[model samples]
Target: MTSDLFDLTGKVAIVTGSSRGIGFAMAQALAEHGAKVVISSRKEDACTEAAKQICDAGGEAIGIPCNIVENDDLDNLVQKTKDAFGKVDILVCNAGISPFFGPATELPDDKFDLIMRANVRANIHLAKLVIPEMKERKDGVIIIISSVAVKKGNNTTAYSISKAAVDQLVRNLAVENSPDNIRVNAIAPGLIKTHFSRVLWENEEALNKRLSKVPMRRIGEPEDIAGVAVMLASKAGNWITGQTFFVDGGDTIDI
Candidate 1:
């Protein structure tokens, strides 16, 4: 009875890039808490496997492959999820990319464009597409998985810039839709043990260096971020909107 506040018994959620990593963990968590989850990513095989894992665990889930950069794919994702679940109560924009590594001055135009497209433009596209339905229902939640890289300095210049843009996007969307009962927010995770962040946590020297600054003395895991996603999407976070959660293990504070 005490846990009922977080119950998502009748909610449906769409999590992009949910085949693995933080996205997969959040999808699984949401499903476990009673939301019908739509697991999507660029790879059909991976999406299928992720959905199976959740189902095998007795959670409601389905796989829908999508490449977020493509508008057609985003359209299909929304349509498929709505067909399968009737309505989307939650949207997790977790798909992101950082295709280049260099100083900001040395960054190439193509790489910058790619980063913006994947991290910023794609989110805007998905939100706009989903907003109409959310508006109709007079209820919705959008969680954009931004990064702590935007707060502290990261070697990936374009990536950080893209994330910063996402933060602003959250603010603008939330303000615009708050009156309609839609809540928009961002989660900034730091050095989580995901494939996307392997370069920072896999190497011994790099791992130790990162850990040294974190007050927790350990790197974050996907589940750490997943818990917050559940809150922000469920009744537990009903009053919260236009906020960015820093799930970093003190990385942002130490910096």
Candidate 2:
């Protein structure tokens, strides 16, 4: 049963910031493959709507609002998921913030701190919440959504640095948790057409400049990253761990 390799029946997954964009796509795909998914974001209304859409499509899903920057909210998300599904088998730290875009030298201290907290520290906290149970069960998957921004120096210094930090975090966590059969990995996307990336792709000149570097000659859709996430969360990727996959349409090849 080749298809069985990717079947996620009985799996429980929590996807942060899943109200829309890449996170929503991944959550929908995971549920379609038989995983019970939790759709989370800062807004309760948005989360509820997204979750309802999945349910209307015949998938098991629920929405739980969470602000990644808040430790208490992170705790509640994990706890609520357990109350709903008993255990967590997959966690996607897809929520991130890039509120600042400027030269590294000119980045304000407050903005830099906010980026690190939301993109880096918050992920660590969420992972810690699920890991103890994962270690006990001897099976788990953690996928952090990174960005191609880490591959080169860019104006978005704080955001890029935060993603690079998570890249290393994936490797370190993979090594530490491998003994427990837990897999940790990252997916770094490039020039994706999402709300978070509207600033880059919405502008004609900026889009052209970015497309020129992308061998694929087009920007990525949220679904482009969703499939990779499914692979990482299922038995299809059972033997894989500690690697950062570049899903950037060959943009990094030239960089």
Candidate 3:
């Protein structure tokens, strides 16, 4: 029975932005652990392909395209997941955007608002949609993918600010939902070798500069964050709540 602690049999999970990168990895990991997974992103083809990959690997999965910035899409995503799988036991708010990579002061008002809406507000909306069912069931897990950028001031200020808000959102939600046995947490990952992060990691000069701050001396892979999500979603993390786990290869701790 002890071995069953990480098992997620009969659980249903929805992972946003799961077409690729960290979101896809988390969805795959959850599915491998016996949870039925919904692979969702803005692109239907990408979502379908990602879900098919999981299914090909013998995991139960479905593709549901969702644009997280849209309230209607978020509602439909939750409703469709429930319609297909019965109930959502796990929610991974991994979809986010950082359209502007400039100084905070120079960030356009529109871009700043977009970053906040997509990176911060979207997660809050999704959580609101799923928490009621979680309360009714008296069990649920919400994992938002934050960023290590929040730890330092950089050109990516708008994005960093958005993630900071997300970190607080996790804490606040955890405090509010702890009484209902619901857990809300976040994962703040450092520079990873994902398409979304290619700009940071692909340039040898910039990559080396960033690596210097990471004690691990290397970039992370999507799988690096997936394991943590598994732990947080399963019984292994039942006692843990309202925390942000940094999977940045020691980048956050280094000077």
Provide TM-scores for the models. 0.97, 0.98, 0.98
lDDT of 1 by residue, 180-231 (tens): 9999999999889988888777799989987988889899888999999999
lDDT of 1 at 240: 95
lDDT of 3 at 53: 98
Per-residue accuracy of model 2 over 16-69 as CA lDDT, tens digit each: 999999999999999999999999999999999999999999999999999999
lDDT of 3: 0.94
Best by lDDT: 2
Model 2 gets an lDDT of 0.95
lDDT agreement with native, every candidate: 0.92, 0.95, 0.94
Question: Distance (Å) between predicted and true CA of 239, model 1?
Answer: 0.6
Please provide the root mean square deviation of candidate 3 (C-alpha atoms, Å). Answer: 0.9
Per-residue lDDT tens digits for candidate 3, residues 123-201, read 9999999999899999999999999988887898888999999899999999999899999999999888999988887
Rank by TM-score (best first): 2, 3, 1
- Residue 142 alpha-carbon offset, candidate 1, angstroms: 0.3
Ranking by lDDT: 2, 3, 1
Instruction: Please identify model 3 stretches exceeding 4 Å from their true place.
Output: none
